[model samples]
Target chain A: MTLQRPVFPLLAFIAATLMAAPLQAREALASWNDGPTRQAIVDFVARVTTTGGPDYVKPEERIAVFDNDGTLWTEQPAYTQLLFALDRVKALAPQHPEWRRKQPFKAALAGDVKALAAGGAKPLMELIATTHAGGGPEDFQALAAEWLAHAENPKFRARYDRLVYQPMLELLDYLRANGFKTYIVSGGGVEFLRAFAERAYGVPPEQIIGSSIVTKFVLVDGKPALRREAKIAFIDDKEGKPVAINAHIGRRPIAAFGNSDGDLEMLQWTTAGAGPRFGLIVHHDDAAREAAYDRASPVGRLARALDEAPQHGWVVVSMKKDWKVVFPETPKP
Target chain B: MTLQRPVFPLLAFIAATLMAAPLQAREALASWNDGPTRQAIVDFVARVTTTGGPDYVKPEERIAVFDNDGTLWTEQPAYTQLLFALDRVKALAPQHPEWRRKQPFKAALAGDVKALAAGGAKPLMELIATTHAGGGPEDFQALAAEWLAHAENPKFRARYDRLVYQPMLELLDYLRANGFKTYIVSGGGVEFLRAFAERAYGVPPEQIIGSSIVTKFVLVDGKPALRREAKIAFIDDKEGKPVAINAHIGRRPIAAFGNSDGDLEMLQWTTAGAGPRFGLIVHHDDAAREAAYDRASPVGRLARALDEAPQHGWVVVSMKKDWKVVFPETPKP
Candidate 1:
């Protein structure tokens, strides 16, 4: 410069900086702390996507499945759906006077968590059937969308939409960016999760495979509609997870992520496939930022799956240690 | 002082010619004669794909459902699957000695087409079950693939893969090229169709929704496998088509193409969706290029749907008039 080196123009410097910005800004899984879990994901994806690599998967075969509840969003303090079910029970209780005196509905109306838990599986199943069926699929979708838009997370004091893990969201985008097709394979109701999955998780309704009640296509007053029936069509959890994945996706996922025992079989099925695969467990250990009760929690119990991860060579993503942030930023009001 | 033009390099000339070749040679639905049926497809696709147009549909919502049998390939000499099923029964007759005496199995084993046809729905269902179940999903897939790869259509003297309509194949590619996600909503066995669908139709396994037998996930020698059962999981036909479309795709298709009465509800459901929709019924009137039967045919009957097409604003693709050719060219040995 002292020897008359040309001085760069300000606009030129800004343009150059802007040109270089995308390279740095392209980093994905940003919420994840620099750790083995994140590194494993990047390495696996890199190997799988690299042309002519031994582990390279065809774009069509690069399927990734994620469990919904505790895995993607919060399920502790009662599964979000269970809370919705209880609320729906109370809402319908006004019409069904006898339900007010019923065990589950009685406990649900009283807002006694312990009593609802004690009311057992029968009552809970009944609540789900009543709330989920007897209406058109569109009607159920509307009900769910309305609830999710307004429903609050009791402990977090935020809406349920705000409770989804930021890291998981980033991971989803990262996988998709790397030619991976992401699917939500959850125990949650298909129509229930389908209502908000596209907006909440960037997954399409068709890609979300979950438990479903029997639904029939009918003509209601000259209008074609799919009316949900009370009978269970499929329960996509545990063993059912892999079955649903096979039935719907028809390809074994190369990568699978989950948070509880319910996902154990899905992870196993995914990893058991020939060639390089990735299995992840989102360990909810952040008691401060979020609820933490592994191996003992009533709602998202991390039992057999957590213990088996090491043997299966799966990365356990520690929510407490590995995440810079939990939920995504709450949108400005 | 000479006025001279520069000579073009041979390679450059060749590259330019190659670039121009597609424009001059390329044509979609070439097997389709220049008619309203072909024009309707082009117009509907253009309207739906044109941005800001009243009929414009977002690429993500541009779902197209197609029937597999007579619509896409030959089904005149009995559905391709039924022939495969009959062959399987004969192959497995040794395992079940009692089948030798049973009415349907005996007929299937003896290669009595007339007897099997007269045996009714019970025998038909039994044949589907036997061929579909009693093996792992992969086993069924391998069996189906092996058969399709080797089996030739006696009348056409061509393999089933070679029997797929050239026009339909072109149509599938055109739809996909226009950002429409093409799906096979078939009455054939799920695994049966899945075997050849990818290569034959350019449709992936996940996009092929068809009749499926119940499958249970089981561990055989520490290997996770899905074992098919005799029970029906779901039938992807008739009214069931709409239900299957909703359950699997979770969206109302904008365009539906079918060849039988079984596809009526699917077409109706597709067209009734409050927007620019297309419904096409392939009326097999070409007894020369292909077998012709509609009202009187037991297989791929086109009575109710064909009669109702005009009322629903659906286009009836007259195979005789519409198709310049029926099947694809036979590959060199």
Candidate 2:
């Protein structure tokens, strides 16, 4: 039953090499561009991190929180997780009659995106509550895995998982390389996001503070089950983002990123801190490459925040103008 | 299965008040003027955290790692976890006879502390391996919980769970309140420590980086089981602390706390950071209220590092001289 011991020595060697390496040589977001937006991020990080800098922030106070949907990854057409939930509802449709008659469910099952959108946030939430609620944490996690494995974006015909933005992936890696313990302070359901976040984002489930359904630990059939409770613990969107960040992370971030007004409060909270801070908003201005919908978009609307960007000193990144590529494959578009 | 919607206005109001409340002030550790030792800890935290201060460290870089045994909680006489392992050995003894005759197991069964120590680290490790290995993660967690609920410290006659140091508890709470994400980086088995850490230390299992037996995802009797892989992933003690911290936490800690030479590497790693950092070593100098053994003690010994404390700028906290109280109740010798 004893563990074989040789693995320790190998790990030890790798760790030593990593520690001994110079921090400056590490891969970082700074490698991207010399534009004001990229420079702002680099300068802010440098000012807060440098020992003698006026805006120097201590290592303990270096909390940098990120919004997941459009901030860390692409949230286009509809939130990718919502797509998963829709697929889950389809898979579980045989068991329930209520879903067939349900407005949003019926619309979703009928492949009527227009009808589903008309149902608005309330009905969308209902769809989430149906598929995401009632199961134990593990059961929900398995369901998420099952759906993610087979689910594809209808328009692009690409696996939903493959649609994550490449630049944001590099940004996460860059932030961590600079001693920032990156956290996903998102509007997505915590459990649903957590199910595959560790693999996709490298942010462990514990570090992900997001919207959550209330869950209770109960003994079901003599086994412990973390059952989805009836109440909603926290909805991490708009004002809820800052509230959830403070409650779960227990710290104000030094930097925040978002693409829409939903993340406005979080960005304000991060910038309000004493030290140097960065707030960047990714503007979807590239219609030729990626689907460009901003001010009028039903999902991830950037209207109110877009107007307030200049006054807040937030970096409004124009997707078409600033970036050399949109998706990982730029030549195709 | 859908969650019932509750009135949102009330919840939002309550959440706002909670987030907006002023910091809960507690009695300062600095007020205790037992010696410069206590002052050192306060000074270290202040210098590192204060914005615009000479040694200011940012919130993102504020990683503080603490050793569980003899640091956060008591590990006197023998490690509380080792005792749990021994009790588990006895509980499962009826099923296995080779353990009754085995070197370390025989000594453990005989209740001979001297013989158990005489068997050295290898045998002690062997005993632990035999008892802690083989079982899946959940099984081990359940076994740990059962033992913790019932096991009492032989000398104190108090449940092992009740033996935590009150001051250290306050320290953890205070640090966490000040934006530090506290993690337990211990030599104790990861799964074993995880079973009780959340309840006892308020640290979630994912934040715990420690020695571990590798486990694999497998289907056991048609149910998915994270089966114990016969490989040691990492043994988090001494030199292993920094390595494990790097691997699991992916950040070098700004502050590190420990009581023995086993934690020296972790302390070294913490202080090696560019900006502000702190390292505190607990010196067991009390013999009247609590068992005092340091340089010569086989258990939780602080020999090598304690000898060169001043040179390394390490703060050596004398238990008897610095603290007005030792254990929660001020244990009688």
At residue A86, give the lDDT of candidate 1. 83
Estimate the TM-score of every prediction. 0.91, 0.52
Model 2 misplacement above 4 A: A1-27, A30-33, A118-120, A229-231, A329-333, B1-325, B328-333
DockQ of 1: 0.19
Residue runs of model 1 more than 4 Å from their true location after superposition? A1-26, A114-125, A330-333, B1-26, B115-122, B330-333
Q: In model 1, how large is the Cα lDDT of residue B311?
A: 88
Worst 10 residues of 2 chain A by lDDT: A1-10
Tens-digit lDDT string for candidate 2 (A1-333): 111223344444444434322234224443344577666766666676666778877665667787887766667677777777677778889997787887778887886665665444455666777778887665787888777777777756776666666667667775665567788878787777777777777887657877666555444563323467545555678766765554344446788888888887777667765657778898888778677877778778888878877876988887776665555553111
Top candidate on TM-score is: 1
Q: Give the TM-score of candidate 2.
A: 0.52
Candidate 2 lDDT, tens digit per residue, B28-136?
3422345677567656666766668888776656788989988877777788877876786787799988877777778788877656654434555566677787766
